[model samples]
Target: MKKTTLLLAGLLLVSQLGMAEMKKDVKFTEKTYGVCSREMSVEVVDGKIASFSAVRGCPGNLNALSKLLPGMEVERVIDLLDDNYCSGAPLAGYTSCMDNLVEMLKYHVMGEGEGHIQEIRKNQKAGRKVVAFNGHICSGCGLCNAQLS
Candidate 1:
């Protein structure tokens, strides 16, 4: 009887430990600018991407990204996608859908980087163009200097 009781207690302790180690999934969504995609969504589990999707972007490329990004660490995705540029569209303002995804992951998921995401959202709401790079407002052009000042 004592041995059976001890075995039951051990099983309970193991179950509790398993529950403690399980991480909750987090979902994040953001609107993107200067790219074909209008919005993006990500699901993170255990600090890695569980799923990804983009709305209104290049179908083939976005589909590929959606498949490849899952199971990758959030920081690794940011590192790989940052600074991606698309020159085909002059109105893209030197940003691509992938770069915008990096921004979303940095600001929303990992909680790193400056407030470039907020600034971009504000400017987008006001129907203005915002150029950003590496979490800073782009100072290379004078168009957005007023915001800096």
Candidate 2:
């Protein structure tokens, strides 16, 4: 009982420290790419996309993505679209400009030293609450059980 209580206390402290480490300064970054959009700039505020723009690419698609990016968290954007390729398009060996922009943000704005996942791992190594929650189905609906399996 004593050990369990100590472990829970340690986890709570680690969780708070992880949250503190995530508070980073706002930043802006720009980069030039080889494909569709030749260049782009991204602004990050409080770990969310403040704004973004691209040059020399599909006007409609690029513009749409540019508008959608604002207010979305940068890490969420990277998880949803990184490495996504153009489907059935004439441009061979082409990936979406959105993906490229996400890449730029991850590598440039977020910095090469520590990415979102890496930070979680680093914190866990130092005893952070890397997995904060777990769920169980009371009625045995099987959805959560299937996912776990």
Candidate 3:
């Protein structure tokens, strides 16, 4: 019984230390592709989302997400929004603003998915036309218009 108690305490301490190592008190911003939202920002505090906002998108849905996402663990938010889709349109790459948020979190906060993000940024920096979906550049595209209509 004494050995069991000591083992449990040690495990708890180790878990707490691990949690302490998590990213916190940082803000991340990313430009989204193939979505109505032009950009998104997330603020994380103590390994949880402190706030989230998008520049422009479905106001109602984005507002709802803005309210709902705060206080959620970063990993949990990623899990919830991963592979989320909107409009199901080929031009949109079958991805939604929420999925973009997930990608932002994965790349910035969790240090995952950095390659794709870095590549996109690199192309943009070089003034090379970056195609977001299906060999199409998103600028002035009528695809979003079609989805809206």
Candidate 4:
């Protein structure tokens, strides 16, 4: 039964479009906390990684992400992502990242009250780009940069 289930899962994954190709330099990471799955890849141009992407799902948007991150330094990109997305690991080992993301989301909602991310969502809805970190949008809102004496 276990083998059958495994086989079926493999088949299902294979059936997914755009997954058959071997993805180059694809990295995966998972924390021991929750089920957050992050896949990242650095795009290379002129012998350097030009950009990066942290996406949910094992083989997500590889092509699009590669195109988007066209000039990022590999090490620097990995360092930036490590703080939130974590380091390389297998797809089955992403519990920690999931836990971290969930906890972060929870804390922001608790600290700032419900709908703390609502402003970012609103901006996104209005076709504005929203940059968020740890579930909080760093919109120069002064909420984060405010001096806490």
Best by TM-score: 3
Clashes of each: 0, 0, 0, 16
- Lowest lDDT block of 10, candidate 3: 140-149
Of the two candidates 1 and 3, the one with more favorable TM-score, higher being better, is: 3
Candidate 2 residue 6 Cα shift, in angstroms, is 5.0
Give the range where candidate 4 is weakest over 10 consecutive residues by summed lDDT. 108-117
Report the lDDT tens digits of candidate 2 across residue range 59-141. 89878888998998878888887766554322222335655565566665555434322332233345422221235322222
Estimate the TM-score for candidate 3. 0.62
Candidate 1 residue-wise lDDT at 35: 66
In terms of TM-score, how similar is model 2 to the real structure? Answer: 0.54
What are the models' TM-scores?
Answer: 0.60, 0.54, 0.62, 0.23
List the candidate 4 regions with Cα displacement exceeding 4 Å: 1-47, 50-64, 85-149
Worst 10 contiguous positions by lDDT, candidate 1: 140-149
RMSD of each: 10.8, 15.5, 8.7, 16.7
| lDDT for predicted candidate 4 compared with the true structure | 0.38
Model 1 lDDT tens row, 31-147: 776666788888999889999998987899999989999999887887898877777432344567887777777666655555445544444445555545446665334345333
lDDT of 4 by residue, 60-139 (tens): 54445456446655434434443343344221222234223323223222232232123322333454333444455533
